[model samples]
Target: MSRTIKHEEKYQQFTIELDGDEAELAYACPSEDVVDFTHTYVPKSERGNGMAESLIEEGLKYAREHNLKVKATCPAVAKYINAHPEYKDLLAHP
Candidate 1:
């Protein structure tokens, strides 16, 4: 199923509401042009449904649009970046 992801800048997270529960990918901006993906959470019922991938994609897209490099501190986000080489260029230098 297609889901609508919402970026809540105030909360520094991307979220999707599913079956009245919310799945979120939280992030932090430590520098002017860097976005650090800090955590990802999917409701138990929402797991295995690509909710985390969707949030990661949206978060990366947002960072790209705003010309921000990415730092994937969250394991899920790091795994996604590793699996998707297309997004590797967006990673911030270590």
Candidate 2:
């Protein structure tokens, strides 16, 4: 048997940096206990580095710390939750 193939991560690694120039990722909240996860958009130049995930994670972390809930309307946010069910409870009310 002979098989050779390269393996790589399908997505970028999530990370957040509070630099003066780093994009804020457009985190938004329309109301209390509600976070609009989809509004955030990382620049194309910054794509494929999990930067979006980092931003979402950071925002959610903030909400958790502040005892606030989240409404993952953003596709990225929902994808993250899909990858991490621990955050399923954060999904917005039906």
Clashing pairs in 1: none
TM-score between model 2 and native: 0.65
Cα error, residue 50 of model 2, in Å, equals 1.3
Report how far off residue 67 is in candidate 1 (Å): 0.8
Residue lDDT tens for model 2, 19-93: 333433344556866656545565566667666666677766766776767777667777788998877776677
RMSD of each: 0.9, 11.1
**What's the TM-score of each model vs. the native?**
0.95, 0.65
Worst 10 residues of 1 by lDDT: 43-52
The candidate scoring highest on TM-score is: 1
Best by lDDT: 1
| Residue 23 error, candidate 1, Å | 0.2
